[model samples]
Target: MQIKLIAIGKTDNSNLITLIEDYTKRLSFYIKFDFEIIPDIKNVKHLSEAQQKDKEGELILAKTQTSDILILLDENGKQMDSVAFSSYLQKHMNSGIKTLIFVIGGPYGFSNALYNRANGKLGLSKMTFSHQMVRLFFIEQLYRGFTILRNEPYHHR
Candidate 1:
Protein backbone atom coordinates (compact mmCIF):
# COMPACT_ATOMS: atom_id res chain seq x y z
CA MET A 1 0.00 0.00 0.00
CA GLN A 2 1.06 3.55 -0.66
CA ILE A 3 1.30 5.87 2.35
CA LYS A 4 0.60 9.58 2.04
CA LEU A 5 1.05 12.37 4.59
CA ILE A 6 -0.93 15.55 3.94
CA ALA A 7 -0.29 18.68 5.95
CA ILE A 8 -1.19 22.33 5.62
CA GLY A 9 1.42 25.07 4.94
CA LYS A 10 5.06 25.03 3.96
CA THR A 11 7.78 24.17 6.40
CA ASP A 12 10.12 27.16 6.26
CA ASN A 13 12.92 25.89 8.45
CA SER A 14 15.64 24.45 6.27
CA ASN A 15 16.84 22.11 9.00
CA LEU A 16 13.42 20.51 9.42
CA ILE A 17 12.97 20.15 5.69
CA THR A 18 16.32 18.38 5.37
CA LEU A 19 15.46 15.88 8.11
CA ILE A 20 12.02 15.22 6.69
CA GLU A 21 13.58 14.59 3.29
CA ASP A 22 16.09 12.17 4.76
CA TYR A 23 13.39 10.02 6.32
CA THR A 24 11.25 10.23 3.24
CA LYS A 25 14.11 8.86 1.16
CA ARG A 26 14.67 6.02 3.61
CA LEU A 27 10.95 5.18 3.66
CA SER A 28 10.89 4.90 -0.13
CA PHE A 29 13.04 1.77 0.11
CA TYR A 30 10.16 -0.02 1.85
CA ILE A 31 7.05 1.42 0.25
CA LYS A 32 5.69 4.20 -1.91
CA PHE A 33 5.46 7.33 0.23
CA ASP A 34 4.16 10.73 -0.72
CA PHE A 35 4.34 13.95 1.28
CA GLU A 36 1.77 16.50 0.19
CA ILE A 37 1.51 20.06 1.43
CA ILE A 38 -1.62 22.12 1.05
CA PRO A 39 -0.89 25.80 0.84
CA ASP A 40 -2.04 27.70 3.92
CA ILE A 41 -5.42 29.38 3.66
CA LYS A 42 -5.25 33.03 2.71
CA ASN A 43 -6.49 35.95 4.81
CA VAL A 44 -6.71 33.86 7.96
CA LYS A 45 -6.75 37.09 10.01
CA HIS A 46 -10.13 37.89 8.49
CA LEU A 47 -11.67 34.46 9.10
CA SER A 48 -12.94 32.78 12.22
CA GLU A 49 -11.32 29.58 13.44
CA ALA A 50 -14.26 27.48 12.35
CA GLN A 51 -14.29 29.00 8.87
CA GLN A 52 -10.56 28.40 8.43
CA LYS A 53 -10.91 24.80 9.46
CA ASP A 54 -13.82 24.39 7.11
CA LYS A 55 -11.82 25.78 4.20
CA GLU A 56 -8.75 23.73 5.03
CA GLY A 57 -10.92 20.64 5.42
CA GLU A 58 -12.31 21.11 1.93
CA LEU A 59 -8.80 21.28 0.49
CA ILE A 60 -7.79 18.19 2.49
CA LEU A 61 -10.79 16.21 1.32
CA ALA A 62 -10.32 17.23 -2.27
CA LYS A 63 -6.89 15.58 -2.34
CA THR A 64 -8.33 12.20 -1.35
CA GLN A 65 -10.19 9.56 -3.27
CA THR A 66 -13.26 7.86 -1.81
CA SER A 67 -11.40 4.55 -1.42
CA ASP A 68 -8.57 6.05 0.54
CA ILE A 69 -8.52 5.39 4.27
CA LEU A 70 -8.07 8.81 5.87
CA ILE A 71 -6.43 9.05 9.26
CA LEU A 72 -6.18 12.30 11.12
CA LEU A 73 -3.16 13.12 13.28
CA ASP A 74 -5.26 14.56 16.04
CA GLU A 75 -4.21 15.52 19.55
CA ASN A 76 -7.00 13.39 21.03
CA GLY A 77 -6.33 10.42 18.77
CA LYS A 78 -5.41 6.90 19.87
CA GLN A 79 -1.83 6.74 21.07
CA MET A 80 0.35 3.65 20.61
CA ASP A 81 3.86 2.46 21.31
CA SER A 82 6.40 1.84 18.56
CA VAL A 83 5.82 -1.91 18.42
CA ALA A 84 2.06 -1.55 18.35
CA PHE A 85 2.37 1.05 15.64
CA SER A 86 4.44 -1.40 13.60
CA SER A 87 1.72 -3.98 13.92
CA TYR A 88 -0.82 -1.36 12.97
CA LEU A 89 1.10 -0.70 9.79
CA GLN A 90 1.30 -4.41 9.10
CA LYS A 91 -2.44 -4.80 9.54
CA HIS A 92 -3.20 -2.04 7.11
CA MET A 93 -0.76 -3.45 4.55
CA ASN A 94 -2.38 -6.84 4.90
CA SER A 95 -5.80 -5.39 4.26
CA GLY A 96 -4.95 -4.74 0.58
CA ILE A 97 -5.88 -1.09 0.62
CA LYS A 98 -4.47 1.06 -2.18
CA THR A 99 -3.74 4.21 -0.22
CA LEU A 100 -3.66 5.29 3.40
CA ILE A 101 -3.73 9.04 3.94
CA PHE A 102 -2.79 10.74 7.24
CA VAL A 103 -3.59 14.40 7.60
CA ILE A 104 -2.09 17.08 9.86
CA GLY A 105 -4.65 19.83 9.96
CA GLY A 106 -4.24 23.58 10.14
CA PRO A 107 -3.84 25.68 13.33
CA TYR A 108 -7.55 25.53 14.11
CA GLY A 109 -7.71 21.74 13.66
CA PHE A 110 -10.22 19.84 11.56
CA SER A 111 -13.75 20.60 10.54
CA ASN A 112 -16.81 18.55 11.48
CA ALA A 113 -17.00 17.19 7.96
CA LEU A 114 -13.38 16.03 7.98
CA TYR A 115 -13.83 14.29 11.32
CA ASN A 116 -16.87 12.48 9.99
CA ARG A 117 -14.93 11.35 6.92
CA ALA A 118 -11.92 9.92 8.72
CA ASN A 119 -11.43 6.16 9.09
CA GLY A 120 -9.18 6.54 12.12
CA LYS A 121 -7.07 8.98 14.18
CA LEU A 122 -3.57 8.60 15.56
CA GLY A 123 -1.75 10.66 18.17
CA LEU A 124 2.04 10.81 18.02
CA SER A 125 2.23 12.19 21.52
CA LYS A 126 0.11 13.61 24.31
CA MET A 127 2.14 16.81 24.09
CA THR A 128 1.53 19.18 21.22
CA PHE A 129 3.98 19.61 18.32
CA SER A 130 4.39 22.06 15.50
CA HIS A 131 3.04 20.86 12.15
CA GLN A 132 6.56 20.91 10.68
CA MET A 133 8.01 18.86 13.51
CA VAL A 134 5.17 16.37 13.28
CA ARG A 135 6.10 15.71 9.66
CA LEU A 136 9.66 14.75 10.58
CA PHE A 137 8.64 12.70 13.60
CA PHE A 138 5.88 10.84 11.80
CA ILE A 139 8.06 10.05 8.78
CA GLU A 140 10.85 8.78 10.99
CA GLN A 141 8.32 6.63 12.83
CA LEU A 142 7.10 5.20 9.56
CA TYR A 143 10.69 4.29 8.68
CA ARG A 144 11.18 2.73 12.09
CA GLY A 145 7.98 0.73 11.81
CA PHE A 146 9.03 -0.76 8.49
CA THR A 147 12.44 -1.63 9.90
CA ILE A 148 10.80 -3.32 12.87
CA LEU A 149 8.59 -5.30 10.54
CA ARG A 150 11.68 -6.62 8.81
CA ASN A 151 13.37 -7.51 12.09
CA GLU A 152 16.05 -4.94 11.42
CA PRO A 153 18.27 -3.31 14.05
CA TYR A 154 16.89 0.18 13.39
CA HIS A 155 14.45 -0.12 16.26
CA HIS A 156 15.96 -1.28 19.55
CA ARG A 157 13.63 -3.54 21.49
Candidate 2:
Protein backbone atom coordinates (compact mmCIF):
# COMPACT_ATOMS: atom_id res chain seq x y z
CA MET A 1 0.00 0.00 0.00
CA GLN A 2 1.08 3.57 -0.59
CA ILE A 3 1.63 5.58 2.61
CA LYS A 4 0.88 9.28 2.62
CA LEU A 5 1.64 11.82 5.35
CA ILE A 6 -0.56 14.89 5.23
CA ALA A 7 0.39 17.78 7.52
CA ILE A 8 -0.72 21.37 7.92
CA GLY A 9 1.57 24.31 7.04
CA LYS A 10 5.05 24.56 5.63
CA THR A 11 8.14 23.52 7.53
CA ASP A 12 10.33 26.65 7.65
CA ASN A 13 13.36 25.13 9.31
CA SER A 14 15.81 23.93 6.66
CA ASN A 15 17.49 21.55 9.13
CA LEU A 16 14.25 19.80 9.87
CA ILE A 17 13.38 19.58 6.19
CA THR A 18 16.73 18.01 5.43
CA LEU A 19 16.30 15.38 8.14
CA ILE A 20 12.76 14.69 7.04
CA GLU A 21 13.95 14.29 3.46
CA ASP A 22 16.62 11.80 4.53
CA TYR A 23 14.10 9.54 6.16
CA THR A 24 11.65 9.99 3.33
CA LYS A 25 14.27 8.80 0.89
CA ARG A 26 15.06 5.77 3.02
CA LEU A 27 11.39 4.90 3.39
CA SER A 28 10.93 4.91 -0.38
CA PHE A 29 13.06 1.76 -0.61
CA TYR A 30 10.52 -0.25 1.33
CA ILE A 31 7.16 1.25 0.37
CA LYS A 32 5.65 4.07 -1.65
CA PHE A 33 5.61 7.19 0.57
CA ASP A 34 4.28 10.66 -0.04
CA PHE A 35 4.44 13.81 2.12
CA GLU A 36 1.87 16.52 1.48
CA ILE A 37 1.79 19.92 3.20
CA ILE A 38 -1.46 21.83 3.28
CA PRO A 39 -1.00 25.59 3.33
CA ASP A 40 -1.78 27.18 6.70
CA ILE A 41 -5.14 28.89 6.96
CA LYS A 42 -5.04 32.65 6.55
CA ASN A 43 -6.77 35.22 8.81
CA VAL A 44 -6.61 32.90 11.77
CA LYS A 45 -6.79 35.94 14.09
CA HIS A 46 -10.34 36.50 12.90
CA LEU A 47 -11.40 32.88 13.28
CA SER A 48 -11.94 30.89 16.47
CA GLU A 49 -10.00 27.68 17.14
CA ALA A 50 -12.93 25.56 16.05
CA GLN A 51 -13.34 27.62 12.89
CA GLN A 52 -9.71 27.18 11.91
CA LYS A 53 -9.96 23.46 12.47
CA ASP A 54 -13.13 23.34 10.42
CA LYS A 55 -11.43 25.05 7.50
CA GLU A 56 -8.36 22.87 7.82
CA GLY A 57 -10.53 19.80 7.98
CA GLU A 58 -12.12 20.75 4.70
CA LEU A 59 -8.73 21.06 3.06
CA ILE A 60 -7.55 17.80 4.62
CA LEU A 61 -10.63 15.93 3.50
CA ALA A 62 -10.32 17.25 -0.02
CA LYS A 63 -6.91 15.66 -0.38
CA THR A 64 -8.24 12.22 0.46
CA GLN A 65 -10.24 9.65 -1.45
CA THR A 66 -13.21 7.85 0.10
CA SER A 67 -11.36 4.55 -0.09
CA ASP A 68 -8.25 5.79 1.70
CA ILE A 69 -7.66 4.57 5.23
CA LEU A 70 -7.22 7.70 7.35
CA ILE A 71 -5.23 7.78 10.58
CA LEU A 72 -4.75 10.87 12.69
CA LEU A 73 -1.69 11.60 14.76
CA ASP A 74 -3.55 12.68 17.83
CA GLU A 75 -2.62 13.35 21.45
CA ASN A 76 -5.41 11.16 22.86
CA GLY A 77 -4.70 8.21 20.57
CA LYS A 78 -3.10 4.83 21.01
CA GLN A 79 0.60 5.01 21.86
CA MET A 80 2.74 2.22 20.44
CA ASP A 81 6.38 1.32 20.75
CA SER A 82 8.54 1.19 17.62
CA VAL A 83 8.30 -2.58 17.33
CA ALA A 84 4.56 -2.60 17.76
CA PHE A 85 4.24 0.21 15.26
CA SER A 86 6.27 -1.85 12.81
CA SER A 87 3.83 -4.67 13.30
CA TYR A 88 0.98 -2.26 12.79
CA LEU A 89 2.43 -1.17 9.48
CA GLN A 90 2.90 -4.78 8.47
CA LYS A 91 -0.70 -5.60 9.25
CA HIS A 92 -1.91 -2.75 7.07
CA MET A 93 0.33 -3.79 4.22
CA ASN A 94 -1.06 -7.28 4.46
CA SER A 95 -4.63 -6.02 4.33
CA GLY A 96 -4.47 -5.01 0.63
CA ILE A 97 -5.21 -1.38 1.35
CA LYS A 98 -4.77 1.06 -1.51
CA THR A 99 -3.52 4.03 0.50
CA LEU A 100 -2.87 4.71 4.17
CA ILE A 101 -3.11 8.38 5.06
CA PHE A 102 -1.63 9.67 8.31
CA VAL A 103 -2.48 13.26 9.11
CA ILE A 104 -0.80 15.83 11.36
CA GLY A 105 -3.33 18.43 12.30
CA GLY A 106 -3.07 22.20 12.74
CA PRO A 107 -2.14 24.05 15.94
CA TYR A 108 -5.68 23.88 17.30
CA GLY A 109 -5.88 20.15 16.62
CA PHE A 110 -8.44 18.34 14.47
CA SER A 111 -12.13 19.02 14.15
CA ASN A 112 -14.82 16.56 15.21
CA ALA A 113 -15.68 15.91 11.57
CA LEU A 114 -12.11 15.00 10.77
CA TYR A 115 -11.85 12.75 13.81
CA ASN A 116 -14.99 10.90 12.83
CA ARG A 117 -13.61 10.14 9.38
CA ALA A 118 -10.45 8.56 10.73
CA ASN A 119 -9.96 4.79 10.89
CA GLY A 120 -7.58 5.13 13.85
CA LYS A 121 -5.37 7.55 15.79
CA LEU A 122 -1.76 7.26 16.87
CA GLY A 123 0.16 9.19 19.51
CA LEU A 124 3.86 9.80 19.16
CA SER A 125 4.33 10.88 22.74
CA LYS A 126 2.43 12.16 25.77
CA MET A 127 4.25 15.50 25.68
CA THR A 128 3.24 18.03 23.07
CA PHE A 129 5.35 18.75 19.99
CA SER A 130 5.29 21.50 17.41
CA HIS A 131 3.57 20.63 14.15
CA GLN A 132 6.79 20.99 12.15
CA MET A 133 8.77 18.84 14.59
CA VAL A 134 6.11 16.15 14.47
CA ARG A 135 6.68 15.75 10.72
CA LEU A 136 10.30 14.87 11.30
CA PHE A 137 9.52 12.58 14.20
CA PHE A 138 6.82 10.74 12.28
CA ILE A 139 9.01 10.31 9.21
CA GLU A 140 11.88 9.07 11.36
CA GLN A 141 9.65 6.61 13.17
CA LEU A 142 8.34 5.42 9.81
CA TYR A 143 11.88 4.83 8.65
CA ARG A 144 12.75 3.08 11.90
CA GLY A 145 9.71 0.86 11.57
CA PHE A 146 10.72 -0.19 8.07
CA THR A 147 14.28 -0.88 9.21
CA ILE A 148 13.06 -3.04 12.06
CA LEU A 149 10.88 -4.99 9.65
CA ARG A 150 13.80 -5.59 7.33
CA ASN A 151 16.15 -6.59 10.17
CA GLU A 152 18.39 -3.66 9.33
CA PRO A 153 20.95 -1.90 11.54
CA TYR A 154 19.14 1.44 11.70
CA HIS A 155 17.13 0.55 14.77
CA HIS A 156 19.02 -1.00 17.69
CA ARG A 157 17.40 -2.93 20.50
Candidate 3:
Protein backbone atom coordinates (compact mmCIF):
# COMPACT_ATOMS: atom_id res chain seq x y z
CA MET A 1 0.00 0.00 0.00
CA GLN A 2 1.07 3.55 -0.68
CA ILE A 3 1.49 5.72 2.42
CA LYS A 4 1.07 9.49 2.35
CA LEU A 5 1.77 12.15 4.97
CA ILE A 6 -0.08 15.41 4.58
CA ALA A 7 0.77 18.37 6.80
CA ILE A 8 -0.17 22.03 6.83
CA GLY A 9 2.35 24.81 6.09
CA LYS A 10 5.85 24.83 4.67
CA THR A 11 8.83 23.86 6.77
CA ASP A 12 11.12 26.89 6.51
CA ASN A 13 14.15 25.58 8.31
CA SER A 14 16.59 24.25 5.75
CA ASN A 15 18.09 21.74 8.18
CA LEU A 16 14.70 20.13 8.91
CA ILE A 17 13.81 19.99 5.22
CA THR A 18 17.06 18.21 4.43
CA LEU A 19 16.53 15.63 7.12
CA ILE A 20 12.93 15.04 6.08
CA GLU A 21 14.06 14.58 2.49
CA ASP A 22 16.72 12.09 3.53
CA TYR A 23 14.19 9.89 5.31
CA THR A 24 11.69 10.24 2.50
CA LYS A 25 14.28 8.98 0.04
CA ARG A 26 15.18 6.10 2.32
CA LEU A 27 11.50 5.17 2.75
CA SER A 28 10.98 5.05 -1.04
CA PHE A 29 13.16 1.92 -1.20
CA TYR A 30 10.52 0.00 0.77
CA ILE A 31 7.22 1.48 -0.38
CA LYS A 32 5.60 4.29 -2.30
CA PHE A 33 5.72 7.26 0.06
CA ASP A 34 4.38 10.71 -0.58
CA PHE A 35 4.81 13.90 1.47
CA GLU A 36 2.42 16.70 0.77
CA ILE A 37 2.29 20.18 2.29
CA ILE A 38 -0.86 22.23 2.38
CA PRO A 39 -0.17 25.97 2.25
CA ASP A 40 -0.93 27.68 5.57
CA ILE A 41 -4.28 29.40 5.81
CA LYS A 42 -3.88 33.12 5.21
CA ASN A 43 -5.25 35.88 7.46
CA VAL A 44 -5.38 33.61 10.46
CA LYS A 45 -5.02 36.65 12.72
CA HIS A 46 -8.53 37.64 11.75
CA LEU A 47 -10.06 34.24 12.41
CA SER A 48 -10.96 32.41 15.58
CA GLU A 49 -9.23 29.14 16.47
CA ALA A 50 -12.32 27.15 15.56
CA GLN A 51 -12.68 28.91 12.24
CA GLN A 52 -9.02 28.34 11.44
CA LYS A 53 -9.34 24.66 12.19
CA ASP A 54 -12.47 24.48 10.06
CA LYS A 55 -10.74 26.06 7.08
CA GLU A 56 -7.68 23.91 7.46
CA GLY A 57 -9.86 20.87 7.89
CA GLU A 58 -11.59 21.57 4.63
CA LEU A 59 -8.27 21.75 2.85
CA ILE A 60 -7.13 18.57 4.53
CA LEU A 61 -10.34 16.75 3.61
CA ALA A 62 -10.11 17.93 0.02
CA LYS A 63 -6.73 16.20 -0.37
CA THR A 64 -8.22 12.82 0.45
CA GLN A 65 -10.24 10.39 -1.65
CA THR A 66 -13.36 8.57 -0.50
CA SER A 67 -11.50 5.25 -0.49
CA ASP A 68 -8.57 6.46 1.57
CA ILE A 69 -8.20 5.52 5.22
CA LEU A 70 -7.51 8.78 7.02
CA ILE A 71 -5.58 8.77 10.28
CA LEU A 72 -4.96 11.87 12.29
CA LEU A 73 -1.72 12.50 14.16
CA ASP A 74 -3.39 13.80 17.27
CA GLU A 75 -1.94 14.57 20.67
CA ASN A 76 -4.59 12.48 22.41
CA GLY A 77 -4.30 9.61 19.95
CA LYS A 78 -3.42 6.03 20.75
CA GLN A 79 0.27 5.76 21.53
CA MET A 80 2.17 2.63 20.52
CA ASP A 81 5.75 1.41 20.61
CA SER A 82 7.96 0.97 17.55
CA VAL A 83 7.31 -2.75 17.25
CA ALA A 84 3.58 -2.35 17.58
CA PHE A 85 3.65 0.40 15.00
CA SER A 86 5.47 -1.92 12.63
CA SER A 87 2.74 -4.49 13.11
CA TYR A 88 0.14 -1.82 12.49
CA LEU A 89 1.81 -1.03 9.19
CA GLN A 90 1.87 -4.71 8.32
CA LYS A 91 -1.81 -5.06 9.12
CA HIS A 92 -2.73 -2.20 6.83
CA MET A 93 -0.69 -3.68 4.01
CA ASN A 94 -2.31 -7.06 4.51
CA SER A 95 -5.75 -5.48 4.29
CA GLY A 96 -5.09 -4.56 0.62
CA ILE A 97 -5.88 -0.90 0.87
CA LYS A 98 -4.65 1.41 -1.89
CA THR A 99 -3.50 4.29 0.26
CA LEU A 100 -3.19 5.05 3.97
CA ILE A 101 -3.14 8.77 4.68
CA PHE A 102 -1.86 10.40 7.90
CA VAL A 103 -2.51 14.05 8.56
CA ILE A 104 -0.76 16.59 10.81
CA GLY A 105 -3.19 19.39 11.40
CA GLY A 106 -2.65 23.11 11.84
CA PRO A 107 -1.78 25.06 15.04
CA TYR A 108 -5.08 24.64 16.83
CA GLY A 109 -5.37 21.04 15.76
CA PHE A 110 -8.28 19.35 13.94
CA SER A 111 -11.90 20.27 13.45
CA ASN A 112 -14.94 18.33 14.63
CA ALA A 113 -15.57 17.17 11.06
CA LEU A 114 -12.05 15.82 10.75
CA TYR A 115 -12.31 13.89 13.98
CA ASN A 116 -15.55 12.33 12.75
CA ARG A 117 -13.98 11.40 9.40
CA ALA A 118 -10.84 9.73 10.69
CA ASN A 119 -10.50 5.95 10.67
CA GLY A 120 -7.94 6.14 13.48
CA LYS A 121 -5.69 8.46 15.49
CA LEU A 122 -2.04 7.91 16.35
CA GLY A 123 0.18 9.77 18.78
CA LEU A 124 3.91 9.85 18.14
CA SER A 125 4.64 11.02 21.65
CA LYS A 126 2.97 12.27 24.82
CA MET A 127 5.07 15.42 24.54
CA THR A 128 4.19 18.00 21.91
CA PHE A 129 6.31 18.53 18.80
CA SER A 130 6.44 21.11 16.08
CA HIS A 131 4.72 20.15 12.85
CA GLN A 132 8.03 20.25 10.98
CA MET A 133 9.81 18.06 13.49
CA VAL A 134 6.93 15.58 13.45
CA ARG A 135 7.45 15.13 9.71
CA LEU A 136 11.05 14.10 10.16
CA PHE A 137 10.39 11.91 13.18
CA PHE A 138 7.43 10.15 11.59
CA ILE A 139 9.25 9.53 8.31
CA GLU A 140 12.27 8.13 10.10
CA GLN A 141 9.96 5.89 12.12
CA LEU A 142 8.40 4.65 8.88
CA TYR A 143 11.83 3.76 7.60
CA ARG A 144 12.65 2.04 10.85
CA GLY A 145 9.39 0.10 10.84
CA PHE A 146 10.02 -1.25 7.35
CA THR A 147 13.54 -2.26 8.34
CA ILE A 148 12.21 -4.03 11.41
CA LEU A 149 9.66 -5.87 9.29
CA ARG A 150 12.54 -7.15 7.15
CA ASN A 151 14.53 -8.21 10.19
CA GLU A 152 17.11 -5.59 9.42
CA PRO A 153 19.47 -4.08 12.01
CA TYR A 154 17.94 -0.63 11.86
CA HIS A 155 15.82 -1.10 14.95
CA HIS A 156 17.22 -2.45 18.22
CA ARG A 157 15.20 -5.12 20.02
Q: State the C-alpha lDDT per candidate.
A: 0.96, 0.96, 0.96
Q: How close is candidate 1 to the true structure, as a TM-score?
A: 0.99
lDDT of 3 by residue, 1-157 (tens): 9999999999999999999999999999999999999999999999999999999999999999999999999999999999999999999999999999999999899999999999999999999999889999999999999999999998989
Instruction: Count clashing residue pairs in model 2.
Output: 0
lDDT tens digits by residue: candidate 1, 1-157: 9999999999999999999999999999999999999999889999999999999999999999999999999999999999999999999999999999999999888999999999999999999999889999999999999999999999999
User: Model 2, which residues run further than 4 Å from truth?
Assistant: none
How many residue pairs clash in all the candidates, one count each? 0, 0, 0
Error (Å) of candidate 1 at residue 152 is: 0.7
Candidate 3 stretches greater than 4 Å from native:
none
Candidate RMSDs in Å, in order, are 0.5, 0.6, 0.6
In model 3, the worst 10-residue window by lDDT is 128-137
Candidates' TM-scores? 0.99, 0.98, 0.99
As for model 2, its CA RMSD to the true structure in angstroms is 0.6
